[model samples]
Target: MRESDLIYILAMAGVTYLVRMLPLVLLKKEIKNRFLRSFLYYVPYACLAAMTVPAVFFATTYVLGAAVGFFVALFLSYREKSLLVVALAACAAVFVAERLIQWIA
Candidate 1:
């Protein structure tokens, strides 16, 4: 909120940027390691799975209906279905599943 605080924040950001950028610039040609390359290849999938798994189970009924919804959408899309069709199917699955469960209980 103050002038010195703003200056300090700017300097910190500059240093952080340099720290992150310098490593890539310095290591770009040096990292010919196969293990690191393989690690990088799988990191994105690993991150996606990590985030999805926890998020899928974080809410009511473990977001169970939504998980089924996402799977149905993903599967149908994989089969060359239109995105809109897959999305509607998934939303329909969630709505129907939720209503059915509510009705049964």
Candidate 2:
């Protein structure tokens, strides 16, 4: 809306890009240490769990509904395990649940 807000947003965007790019630019070489590389492998799972577990419970029943959808997706994707299928299942579950609730209330 204002010039100050635009400058602040641009500055933040630049900072975020620099922070993310710095790691890739710096770690261009393959890590030699086996232990460290092994540890790095868990980083994605750990970060996702850390971010999601708390939010799942803190948020609404949507999380539980998503869990149901995840299972459904898992089953539907049992042979191929496609990400698209999983995402569709989760979104469909949300939409159906909301509509069902509205009809009931």
Candidate 3:
């Protein structure tokens, strides 16, 4: 609402845009290194896991429920199940585990 807040937000937006855009604009040529290219390719997945893994543990009230869901998802993924199936299976596992825990407690 204030002029100073608007200026600060614009400054932050400009900095973020430049940080993301500069790499693409400056590196006009394709990356050629096998190791570096591979690493770059996996950065998004690594970031995603880093962000998601922590939240998954706290998704349920019971840690055991979350752990069961995580293991079910991992097992399904390891078996090469489709993403939808893996997600559904993990949710189901967590739901069942949580219900069991609630009933016991």
TM-score of 3: 0.66
Distance from true location, Cα of 70 in model 2, Å = 4.2
Cα miss at 84, model 3 (Å)? 0.4
Q: Top model by lDDT, which number?
A: 3
How many clashes (backbone N, Cα, C below 3 Å) per candidate?
Answer: 0, 0, 0
lDDT for residue 62 in candidate 1, whole number 0-100: 30
lDDT winner between candidates 1 and 3: 3
| lDDT of model number 2 | 0.74
What is the per-residue lDDT of model 2 for residues 13-97, given as tens digits with 9 covering 90 to 100?
9999999999999999999899999999999989977986656443445565556555565577676757887767766876686
lDDT of 3 by residue, 1-105 (tens): 999999999999999999999999999999999998999999999998998888889988888999999999999999999999999999999999999999999
Clashes in predicted model 3: 0
Query: All candidates' lDDT scores?
Result: 0.79, 0.74, 0.95
- TM-scores, all models, native as reference: 0.50, 0.75, 0.66
Off by over 4 Å in 2: 56-64, 74-80
- After the best TM-score superposition of candidate 1, give how far the Cα of residue 2 lies from its true spot, in angstroms: 13
Model 2: weakest 10-residue lDDT segment is 56-65
Candidates ranked by TM-score, best first?
A: 2, 3, 1
* Alpha-carbon RMSD to native, per candidate: 5.2, 2.8, 3.2
Better candidate number, 1 or 2, judged by TM-score: 2
- Give the runs in model 3 whose Cα sits over 4 Å from its true position: 1-29
Q: How far out, in Å, is residue 34 in model 1?
A: 1.3
